[model samples]
Target: MSEALLDIRNLELRYGAAVAVRDISLQVHPGQLVAVIGNNGAGKSSMVRGATGLVRPSGGQVIFRGEDTTRLPANKKVARGLVMVPEGRLLFPGQTVEDNLILGAYVHGGIKTPRSKATLQRVLELFPRLRERLHQQAGSMSGGEQQMLAIARGLMAEPELLVIDELSLGLAPKIVDQLIGVLADLNRTGLTILLVEQLASYALAIAHTAYVVANGRISHHGPSAELARDPEVMEAFLGRKKTAA
Candidate 1:
């Protein structure tokens, strides 16, 4: 069996005295699309922050490619190929789309390098709409286009595991569908993904495995197909329960 690409063992995260995540553990192996689904305030975002080094974990280890990266900062993690398309599609609003993408390649000495230039071209091909608006102000676009650009920016880093938070945040259903298809295609081409999403149905559609997070803990986990069929999962999404299995 292939070794895991990312592993979080008994992760504990806190904000002052309040614990956000308690003993949460997860694993993403090579070439797998894994989803973590939960409602708002379920500690999903907090988990991503800890995993990607946006915030320090009070406990546990973040093992990436068999190396301990728990204490590394966000930039270091990005340099090591663990990139996140953050929540809220945080693009540089005043900058041109091309400028934003170039900034994403900063880890590789900007896009002036041949390898970085080729990667930028591939990213543009993946999101042709971005190519058309390369010179437009990033904030001038629609919500869906901005989200696409945010993802495209992350791609400029050439990540080994792409972690996306709240993919369907503020977009039409059709737009969300299109973006999800793009992610599926990326995964098919050997990109490992760990998607943290509130939309369980969409996330499960592309994931091989999934974990249902509740109250800062993993309440249930299994194949995405099975989780979708589970009554507990349905009820959790419907707000009928505080926990799921």
Candidate 2:
């Protein structure tokens, strides 16, 4: 296998004496879709923030493309091709959809360059609803449409590594399935992704490798298919009862 595109080593994070992540280490390689699945309060989002430089890690090394970027700010990471779609779809509520997309490319010079313009065209092709709502306020859309905008905005950054936090949060099952399909298609086209999702079955179904986080630690790591079939993992994270052998 090639060297990891994003390598996180012994990551420890805290919020004012409360340890959210403890000695967590992981890697995501080029073109691979990796899933981090856990119940609520497992610190999945915290770990992502540390990796992406949204929050400086209390302790750890975040290596991207072989450079130590542990202390870099979030914008710096985005400039270097690590972008995130945060939880809650954090769109500019009052801004037009086009404006939100333009803001996403701010680190890349705000869609003025030829390359950025081509990216915008591609993103619009992927999400036609966004094209239809280009002038519409982002907050005025339905939850599913908003989620589509969030992912489209993330793509506007032209990320080599897209880390999405909570892809299935609060959306209908049909909407979640559609987004998951979109992610799978993106990965097929060589986009590396790290998905942190609460719905274990949906995430595991799409990921090549899976990590099960519990109580701020990784309790299991393996191939996603195997993990999905493991009775223990299913019982714990998928809320399935084990039947008699």
Candidate 3:
């Protein structure tokens, strides 16, 4: 079997006296879209933070490309082509869209790579709407547009692994569809994606593998299509009412 692109083994995280995540283990392969779905306070965000070194894991290991990167700093991770588009669309309110994208390449030690322009051009093509608003302040755009900008900024880093948190949060269904479509296209281009989403149905639609997180633990793990069809998995993650087919 091919080596996994990213691996989390027995990962645990804590906040003060409370355990936020426990024994969370997962593997994401190259060119695959892996979805981590859960309700609020289920340690989903903690897992993302731990993986990116924003929150240190109390135990276990995070291995990326055959290296034990559990102790690597966030900037080092990004420089190694591991990037994240955080939960909120954390764009600079006063900065132009182009500036915000340029900031994403700061992890490369302020030196511009040859692929920078090509990456930006590709991101603009993925989000054609953004090209028109490049000079506009990110804060002035609509929520959907801001989210696009956020994802585009992450793409600017030319990541080997992209972690997206709360992708469909607080957006219209149509906008969510658009964003998800773009993600699917990116995944098709061999960009490994680890997507953290609150909407189970949406995540399962495009993911190759799925993990259902609850009470800081993984409740289910299986093929995305299989999980989507399992009544128990559906009820646990998507809720009974919404999962009825």
- In model 2, which regions exceed 4 Å deviation? 238-245
Instruction: Write down the RMSD of all candidates, one decimal each.
Output: 3.0, 1.9, 1.7
Candidate 3 TM-score, C-alpha based: 0.95
Distance from true location, Cα of 8 in model 2, Å: 0.6
- Model 2, global lDDT: 0.92
Q: Would you list the C-alpha lDDT of every candidate in the order shown?
A: 0.93, 0.92, 0.88
For candidate 2, report its TM-score. Answer: 0.97
* Clash count for each candidate, listed in order shown: 0, 0, 0
- Using TM-score as the yardstick, the better of models 2 and 3 is 2
Over the stretch 76-181, how does candidate 1's per-residue lDDT look in tens digits? 9999999999999789999999999999999989999999999999999999999999999999999999999999999999999999999999888799889999
Clash pairs detected, candidate 2: none
Quick one: RMSD of model 1?
3.0
Weakest 10 consecutive residues of candidate 2 by summed lDDT: 236-245
Question: Which model, 1 or 3, shows the larger TM-score?
Answer: 1
For each candidate, what TM-score against the reference?
A: 0.96, 0.97, 0.95
